[model samples]
Target: MNSKSEALAAAKKRITDLQSQMTAKILAIAAEVEKLMDVTPEREVRDFLRVTCNLPSSELGTYMGFGRTLKGSEALLQKARVTFPVLKALVAADAETRQEIVERMDIGARIDTKEIAVVRKRLTEAKLTPEALMAQKNVRLVAAAARKRSADTAALFREKLASFALHLRKMNASDLALASLSETVRNDALELREQFTDIFGTSRRSLNKINLNSPAFRVAAANDALKRICEGRFGNSSHYAGVKKWPASDSQIIDVLLLLSGHPVPRRGWVRGRNAITELPPHRYRLKAIELCAGAGGMSIGLERAGFEHVALFEYNADAAATLRQNRPDWNVVEADITKVDFKPYRRMDIDLVAGGVPCQPYSSEGDQLGQEDERDLLLESSRVIAEVKPKMFIIENVEGLLHAKHGDHVAEFLRRVAKAGYQTEINRIRAEDYGVAQERHRILLIGIRRELAGSFRMPPRFPERRSNLGDALLDLMSENGWTGAREWARQRRDCPVFDRQGNLIAHGVLASTVVTRRGTPRTKEAARWGSKGINIGGLPAAAPTDAEASKPGYLPGLTARMRARLQNFPDDWKFHGGKQSVADQIGNAVPARLAQAVGLAAFAAIRGVSFDWEAMLWPGDRGRLQMTTPALYLDQPQLAPGRKKPEQNVRTVESAGDW
Candidate 1:
C-alpha cells in the first residue's frame, strides 16, 4: 500500500512539472510573436495569438482555450500568413504598401454576403443570356471595390450595373418607362458598359456572351474581361446569364426569393456621369466623439448609427467593460474609475465631442440634493475631461432634475463652466416620445458647440409624424415568442390604467416615466414593502410605490420587459444579454437610440448645410403644443410646501363683466 501511494504522488508531481514547462514555452512563443510583429497593445497581441492558433472567435470559447492554444504550431503560422496576407504584409512591407493592403482587406471584409446572393438570384430569375451572369458578378465586385477605395472608377461601374438591374426590374420597355429609366437607370447602365468595353481589350459583345453557369468558363475567363464587365468577377458572367435564362421547371420566383432572403442590401448605389457621383458631404467642422460612463455600448450603438465614431469610451464597471469589449473589440474602453483616469489621451486624439450622462443619484428627486458634494458628482469629472479635451462640441445628458437642482444654481454653474471652456451652449428638455420612441422619459440635453462652429451647428430636425405608440412598440414584444421574461410581466399588469378619452381603466400600454434609482431609502412606502418582499415595481425597490397600493388595479409594478425595451428604443429584434433584472438595468441606463440618432442626423445636416424636416418628429399627443413645464424645470423644482405660493397665485385675475 505504501509503495502504491508513493507511485501515485510521483505521477502527480510529474503532471505538475509538465504543465509548468508547457506554460513557459507558451509565454516564450507569445513573446517571440509579439516581437516579430512589433505590436505592443495587449488586446491586439491577444487577438493575433487567437487568430494564429485558430481559437474560436467568441469570448467564452477563447477564454476557455487560451492557455492551451497559445503555443501554435509552425504549420498553423504558415496557414495564417496565406489566409491573412494583408496582415502579413502589414508586418513585413513598407508603410505605403501595408496601408494599401490593409485598406483593401477592410473593403473586402465589408462586402455583405446578402447583396451578392440577391444579385445572383435576381439574375437567375430574369432569364437573361448566359453572358449576363458575368455582368452581374462584375458589377457586384466593382461596387465592393468602389466602397472600399472610395474611387470614382469603381463607382461608374456600379452605377451602370444598378441602372441595368433597375431597368430589368421595372420591365417597362415603353418610351415613357424607358425615358424615365433612361434619365435614371438606363444612363447608368450605358455608362457602365462603355467603361467596361474601354477597360477590357475584348469587345462588350464578346464579354457579354460567355456562359456564367459553367465552372470551366470561370476558370478560363481573363482577369480584365471579368473585372471590367461585371461588378466583381468570380469569372464567367455569360454562364451566370445562361443560368438565369434557362427555364425554371419548378417555382423559380419562389425559389429565387427564398435563396435571396436574409441578404443585406447595399446602402449606396452608383449614378451615371461625373456629376452624378454621390458622396457624404464634408462636415463644416470635423467632429470627434468620446463616450463617457459607457455601459455595454448601448449609447455607442446609437452614436455609430448616427455616423459619429467614438475615439474613447470610459466605463468603471468591469462587467459592462467586458460587454463593450465583447461587442466591439476595436473600441478604446478604459476600465478605470472615471475620476482616476487621465483625460489627456482624448485631448491628444483631438476629440471634438464629449458625451455622457453622469449617474443621476445626487440630481434625482428622491435622492439627497448633495449638489456639489454628492459622491456621484462624477459630472465634474466629465467637466474636467471636457476642459482638458477641448472638443468642438460637448453633449451632456441626465435626468431632468439636473436642470432644476439647487433652484437652478447647479444648472447655471454647469453652463457657466462649459462656456468658460470656450463653447456656446444651448439647453433643451427633450422627451424620448417626441423622437419616435414610445417612452415618456424626459431628459436634460445640454449641447455646447465651440464658439467658432456654433454659428453653423443646428439641432436635428424632428420627425414629421410620431412613428410609434406604446402598443405599437410593445404588443408584438409581449407575444409568446417575442422577448423572454416579458409575457408573464405583461399578463400580470393587464388591468392597469391606460389614459384614454373616457374615465375607464384600460390596460397600461403607454410608456411610463423614466426609471430612477432611489438611493438610501425607497421612493414610497409601497416600494419599501415590495422591496422587503423582493418584488418591488420597476425592478428597483427604491423606485417602487408603497404597499397600500399592492392590490390596487390601476398601479403598475415596475416596467414590463417590453416596456423597458421600448423606452430604450431598441428594435424588437435586438436582444439583451442578461436576465430580466439585468435587462431592465441596461434599458434604464441607455440613452434612447432614436434620440441619439436624431441628434446625430441633425448635427450632420447642420454641419453640411442640408435640409431636414424636424416638425414631423413630435408625437401626436404633443403636436403643436409644448408640455406645460420643461423637463429641466420640472426636475429642478423642490416639493412645494402645502401653503407655498404657486405660479398661478401670482397671476393677475381679469375683472368681472360688471366692472367692464
Candidate 2:
C-alpha cells in the first residue's frame, strides 16, 4: 500500500482503540457510582459528582443510568467495543429496539448514533420491524424514493390536488353543519373565500351567489373547483390554479378543523402567503397580549407585571370580570364566552402572546375528570384561539390532573391541533411554593411557541429554597383581630415538620394544602388535615382570630378570604368583588400571581430573545411590601422567644381588603 493509505489505516486503528478505552472508562465509572450508592446517601453522592468531580448533570445521569440499563450486557458491549455515544443512545432506546441494536452489535455490525436515531424514528413513526429495518431495501431507501418522486413540480401539484379531491368526497353535512361550526371556522371560511375570489379573479358577484353555510352549496363548489382543476384551470382550462399567490393570513382554523375530521387540508393553495411575518404596529409596551378566562385578575396582573400590555381580557365570570375592572380600569375586559369569541381580528394586529388560565374543574381531582366531555373544558377552544390569534407564544394554566392517564388522548389531540397551527407545545408542571407562593398547589402549564422558536423557550428556573410556609406568609393577617394565641399558633405552624406522600420527612415547615374553592363547611377528612396543621377548616372565617375566640375550650383559627389570598401570593391591595362564596371561588381558582409571573417572564425572555436578572425581576422590594410589613417567621432554625411580649397598643399595620 502507498504511504498515505498506510498512515490513514493506522489513524483509524488509533481512533477505534481510543473509543474502546472511553467506553470502558464510562462503564467503570458507572459501576463505581452504583457501588458508592450502597454506602453513601444518593443526594450526597450526586452533589459530590456535580460540584467536586465537575461532571455535567446530563453526562452524569447517562453514566449512572448505564448501571441499571446495561448491567448484565457489559460483556457483550466489551465484545462489540462500541463507542460511548452509541452506548448512550442504546441506553435511551426502548427495550425492544435496544435489544435489537445490541443483537446487531453482537453480530459485529458497525453502527453509529445517527443510524440509531434513524432506526428509532422509523420504529416510532412508520412502525417498522427490526428485520425490516435491517433488510437490503430499508425504510430509509423507501422513504428516499418516495421523497424524490414527491419533489417533481408537476407530480407534487397532481398529488396535492388528488388528496384534496379525496377530502371533498369524504366531506359530509356533519362537517359543515352551522350548529357544529365554531366562530373560528366561520371566520376562517369567510377570510379564505375572499382570498379565493381575488385569486381566480372570480367576480365577487359570482362568489356571493354561493351560500357558504349551506352544505349542498359548499359540496357543489368543491366539486366545481375539482373539475376546473382536472381541466388545468381555476375558471378556465388555460388558467393555471397552481400559480396564484395565496393570502398572507396565518389564520388556518377552518382547514385545521377539517383536517382533524379526516379531510385533507390544502394549506399550499389557500394560505401559502401566511409564511410572511406580519410587521407589528409600534407600541408602548414590550409585548401585546390577549388573555382568556382572566379570572379575578391573578394571571392578568402577573403577566402585566411581566411586561405585557393586554389589548383585551376575556372572562365569562361576571364577578371575575368585575374584579379585573375594579383593579385595572385601563384593561379592556370583555365578559363573553371564549367559545364564541372571534380572535381573528387580532391576527393581523401582531399579538405577541396569548395567555389563559382556563377552568380546571373539568380535570380537577375534586370533580369527575370528564375532560373533553365536560362542557366547561375549553382546552380545544384555547388552541383554536392560538390558531386564530397566531401569537408568538401561549400559556394555558390548568390543574395537574390534566396530565393524568385518563386525559392522555385529549392532551395528545390538543397538542396535535396546536401543532397544525405552526406551534410546538409541551406540558410543564409547577409547584406554587417553588415560585414563592405558600400553598402546596401544583398546576400544569401548557406552553406553546411558534415552530421557529421551539428550542428557544424553556420553563423558568425553580427556587425550592425560597418556598415559604403558610404561617410566614399569612402571620400579619392571622393576628389582626387581637388574638393573644396568634403568635404561638404562627410559631407552631412555622416549626411544623413536613412529610412526603410516602410518609418520609421532606421539609421542616409545612405549606397549606391546595386552597379549595368551596366556601361551605369542610368535610371530615379535610378538617382533620387542617387540624394537623394547627388550623380550622370547618368554615371560612369572617375575620382573623380574636381574644374571645382564642379563649374558647377548643380554638383553631380558620382562614379568612384575605388570608387565602395571601397564601395565593395576591398583593394585599388587590380587592375582590362579590359575596363571600364568590370571593372564595375567585381566590381559590386563580393562579398564584408569583407563579404566573415566573412563567410569563420565561415566555417573555424566549419570545423577545432576551435574558432577565431573575432576582431583580421576580423578587423586587416593591413587590414584597406586604410581606415586608409582616413579622419575619423563622424558616429553618427554631429559637426560643425571650418572652411573650404584649401586643403593641398602636402596632403599625398595612391596609388590606381582608378587613371587610
- Output the number of the lDDT-best candidate: 2
Candidate 1: Cα lDDT at 641: 20
Highest TM-score model number: 2
Cα lDDT of model 2 by residue, 1-660, tens digit: 999999999999998898778778877887888886778766556655653354666776666677777789888887777777787788888876787788888888888898888777766756656576577367678888877864563344434434443543354544434312345433433444443443333532332355333343443444344333333232222242353322111122234324323455543421233242111112332587789999898898778657676767888889988898787655667888989877787787778899998989999987899999998999999999999999999999999888776776577667778888988777678898888778889998889988667788888889888878877887888888988777778788789888888999878777888888874567778788878887887677789988988888888888899998888788888899998889999998998887888898888778765566665666764432221111222222222122222231222333222311
lDDT tens per residue, model 1, 560-638: 5555655576554445556545655666677887687567556654443344333332112223322111001111222
Q: In candidate 2, which residue pairs clash?
A: 248-273
Clash counts for the predictions, in order = 47, 1
Give the lDDT of residue 87 in candidate 2: 79
lDDT of 1 at 96: 47
TM-score of every candidate: 0.43, 0.56
Give the root-mean-square deviation of each candidate in angstroms.
Answer: 28.5, 19.5
